[model samples]
Target: MCEANAYLIEGDDKNLIMEAVDTIEPDGDNLLICNIFGEQKVVKASIHSLSLVDHKIYLKG
Candidate 1:
């Protein structure tokens, strides 16, 4: 329940990258995101901002 949704921000647009993200780890130059359901993703992006109240994690590539 404490998990957050991940978003990829580009310009003025924000795109949903992952949902119910449980963990995020650094993997070389990329980032590894894991969901509550065991789904995983590797994104070549950097963290932009976090909206804890909204449970959102924003990233920029």
Candidate 2:
């Protein structure tokens, strides 16, 4: 329940990147995201904002 959904922010749009992300780690210029299902992804984006109350993680690419 503590896991958050990840989104990518570009201009005035938001794109859902991952659902139920368990972790977000900084690796050079990329953001590594891992989900509850053990799926993982590395994106070239930085954290833009977090909406913990809504269980969301926003990133800027």
Best by TM-score: 1
Compared with the true structure, model 1 gives a TM-score of: 0.95
Query: Can you write out model 1's per-residue Cα lDDT over 1-61, one digit (the tens) per residue?
Result: 8999999998999999999999999899899999999999999998889997899999998
Q: What is the clash count for each candidate, in the order shown?
A: 0, 0
Per-candidate TM equals 0.95, 0.94
lDDT of 2 by residue, 2-53 (tens): 9999999988989999999999999999989999999999999999899988
Per-prediction RMSD in angstroms? 0.7, 0.7
Cα RMSD, model 2 = 0.7
Per-candidate local distance difference test: 0.94, 0.94
